[model samples]
Target: MAISSEPRLGASTNGDLVNRVQQLRLDGQLGAGKNSRGGGGALLPWVLCGLLAVTWAGVGVRSYKNAGQKADDTASAPQGTAPAASSTNTPQPAGPSAVAEGELVTQLKGNVIPSLQITVSPRDVAAEITEIFFAEGKRVKRGDKIATLLDHLYVNRLNTEVASVAAAEAQVTRAQASQTSVAAKVAKAKSALAAAEARGTRATAMQERAGKDFDQARQQRASGSIALLDYQRFDADKQAADADKIAATADIEAAKREVEAAEAEVKTAVASTKAATADLGAAKARCAEAQRLVENCVVTAPIDGTILTKSADKGALVSPNSFNVAAGICLIADLSKLEVEIDVPERQITRLKSGQSCKLQADADPTREYRGVVDRVMPIADDTKNVVKVRIRAYLKKGEQQGEFLKPKMSITATVYNTPFTFDPSKDLPWGDEATRK
Candidate 1:
């Protein structure tokens, strides 16, 4: 209702305002309508109250229409859009954000994964699984025998190598003996040379003596004091002595040649000895290598752990590097160590960091909560899922670290609260120091 500031007494209007108010007041429509000259005090209050009442009624009608219109609009609009704001006295609550209820916490879902799972394989050697030493699920110390491959084959190879080494050793002995024999021959040749030289010296002396005798015979014969035959005999004797000296010198040279030949034979024998020694060493090395391979046939536990599975039994053929649940020699794990591995979505990965504490609940026992820490935060991400793999080391309560409460490959939920903290590595110690599994 539009109220006019001035009195509308014009004939063009629906009716005179005073007359209208007078009729409504008589009918009790207005609270009081007595007219007064003093600024129309009685009429003013009544008129104002009537206008206010009309205005509120119109507002109520419009509100009802608007509500219907909103309902229709909402029904016709797309699935998820919110309705327009409504006029209310109180304010609306805010949605979840960084400062959630004045605290910062990040929760993630992950599964329980193995921390010290070991699957023994026959890595480079293809051999038949000949025997299993320990029972499955039994605890074993490091270096303890778990199984044995076909060692008979390797043992045969080792024996053959040993025989070869022995043969090479014999060859080396024969070469040494040959060297000794050549050395003796060289000594004999030297002795013969010395004798030849002595003989040449004696021949030289006899020649000189014969030459003097021949000269004396020639002088006597020429002075007719000796016979010609005697002089001729002395000349013949001198010539024979000269010939013996030449022969002796020749024998000395021949002996020297023989000695040189013997020395050459000695050198060849020494070389042969060295070659045999090298061959023996090589054969022995081959034997040692074969022995090592044979040793590998006996498989041993690499860590103090429990055997989770036995994939291969006696007479089963196992290829090196064969692994998995279907076929393998055995699968072992250190039950003392456990971890929860979860894939944190790329968006939430930023809230997690190494050393952050986490609360864990297994799918098997959701009520029982376990404690753990963020052991690692991978720098890389999985492109397909857009997530990062995080490993959480489980912290067993009291002496439960060595207990069998948790098993590997158990599905579990991990709740991690993002906060700054320190992680102690010593808390995870006392691990199996058993020999590293082969």
Candidate 2:
């Protein structure tokens, strides 16, 4: 049967038709074909993907902002705070600070010293050192026996000199006695010559008388008044008288010769006396020298101080000419008076002057300070070290007492304070304007 072209509103043949129509209408709302399922399923996945993308973008933005902030902090940080890879890096300098010109005072202390040095010289052979009476650090006084030399030989020589002097004096006395005796003999010889001359004159007068008698006898013979025998007897008598006169004259000449010989003896005696006197004087001088040498055998202290060094020992040969390597047997120093010697740079020496106040401090006793005055500043600087040796006299101040414990050759540091008259033309000085000129 042919279906009617007209619409049939309520003619439901099967229930499938109604259902198909309802499904078709549902498909239309959803979409058609593959798009319908794909679009619907993709909606949930797309939403989840959108949420993940948004979360990732937010994390990246946060990371970028944090990195930029860190870079800004790094750029603004201080340079000093940065670490260096090597140890050779230098540190930055500090801020500027003010500086001033001021004096620096120091304190020093030292041992004492002697003002004079004494040495003994021996004239004879080298002496053997008998004993050394002093040791280092031992205090000694003037005239104290510090050392001794062998005295046996010197004593013997002195004795010999004494004996020689005595012998010479004895000889002088003997010569003087001899001279007196010779003088007496000379006087006696002179007297004898005078008596002999007087006798000779008497004999000549008797001879003349005898000759006259002989002549008278010859005349008598001529006149025949006397016999020939008598006249010959008279002539013989006259000849005998003349011979007696000649003998008397010869005796007088012999007496004169004896007197002259005696006078010569006296002269010789006087010469001997003079020679003996000279020998006596020489002997006495030698005796005195021997005495002086004996006294020198006992050595004495030359100064008042403490012995600081000693090299002499018993049995050692000591000679003044010997090398003084260790400085004569012992060294004496005056511990009461201490001084410091320092070689100041030449540049600084010009600023120092004598009588300027100074301070000293010894390395041994740092706590104790000593005050002193500048004793001397060398006018010339030493060429070897280009320094001027300055000597300072340090007087112990009241209340600070270091007695005999101070020793010589101790190392010390010293500071010399500027004197009031020190000249400085740069600025106003501590002293008055007049001091500046000096």
Model 1: residue 316 alpha-carbon error in angstroms? 1.4
Put down candidate 2 lDDT per residue, 395-415, tens digits, no spaces: 554433334334456666665
Candidate 1 achieves a global lDDT of 0.75
Q: Which sections of candidate 2 miss by over 4 Å? A: 1-114, 117-125, 200-248, 323-327, 347-353, 366-371, 376-381, 397-406, 417-438
> What's the residue-level lDDT of 362 in candidate 2?
68
Question: Which run of 10 residues does model 1 get worst, by summed lDDT?
Answer: 95-104
- Return the number of clashes found in candidate 1: 3
Top candidate when judged by lDDT against the true structure: 1
Candidate 1, 362-391: lDDT as tens digits: 877888777676779877899998779999
lDDT of each: 0.75, 0.69
